[model samples]
Target: MSAHVPQICVMGVSAAGKSTVGIALAETLAVPFVDADSLHLESNRTKMAAGTPLTDDDRWPWLDAVGAEYAQAGASGLVMACSALKRVYRDRIRAAAPGVVFVHLGGPRELLLERATARTDHFMPSSLLDSQLDTLEPLGDDELGVAVTVDRTPAMLVSEIIERLRA
Candidate 1:
């Protein structure tokens, strides 16, 4: 039988270091890394760049695209970075990839806002941080994943994630 290949989504609100931790985790696990932001339509990116929060209608297609990536990863597995702030969104991804696990990175709003404000290259604006925070639904007890506090270095965070995932 083939070895089990892990599919992981590193999720959280904006500026919670989803991309950074996802990248590090992918490297450590020897999997392909995908930043789900890259799957957003240009129109959605434009709306977010203007500091407008996306409506649920605006996000459905993008969320499906993220799910498609997970489905396409197949035996190769994948590590994805996405702001899966709502339970429905995570459920959407799970529908596409049943074996996928989530790693939720959570931190204080102040720290998230501070990090969002410091970013220069991302399309998301600090103004939308509150919206993201308001929309966040943490992982449930029955979910196949772990919620981690983002209070340490990326290396440290990745280590903790690895340990917890193995547990």
Candidate 2:
């Protein structure tokens, strides 16, 4: 790995195991972990809890806050889990914290749905999965990130990410 540890954003639709993998990755990298959902405005959380999807306006401030958190981490480095579902959203985050790398977690819809259904206490309900998947734009070829399949255990996923980063 480089002398400077990369600030990583674990991104995907809800239930793609971003938080699970991100926490393990942060442990491995010895960096702090933040969940963007925890930073959401109460209004956004209310809407999501009611099964309504947020518009771009609703997301801008939240994304900016997430980006700012990354910028704040600076050389200390951070691993954040966010449903950065669009290219524009990722671009917005990149604009705030340049050189941020995204780890895109992906899996089949059935698996995602199963995970979503199995979760408890999360603000994002299973009903929002389709909307999230609909909005997701896969990482571009030029994007600074790796797409990892989410069919394995969180430890294995973290190991894969660590190996890739080290290489």
Which candidate wins on lDDT? 2
- Residue-pair clashes per candidate, as listed? 0, 0
By TM-score, who's the top model here? 2
For candidate 2, what is the total of clashing residue pairs?
0
Give candidate 1's whole-model lDDT: 0.92
> Model 1, range 66-93, lDDT digits (tens) per residue?
8899999988989999998888999988
At residue 52, give the lDDT of candidate 1.
93
Alpha carbon lDDT of each predicted model: 0.92, 0.93
How much does candidate 2 score in TM-score?
0.97
Question: What is the per-residue lDDT of model 2 for residues 1-167, given as tens digits with 9 covering 90 to 100?
Answer: 46697799999999999888999999988999999999999999999999999999999999999999999999999999998999999999999998789999999999999999999978889999999999999999998888999999999999888788678
Position 23, candidate 1: lDDT: 95
Model 2 scores what on Cα lDDT? 0.93
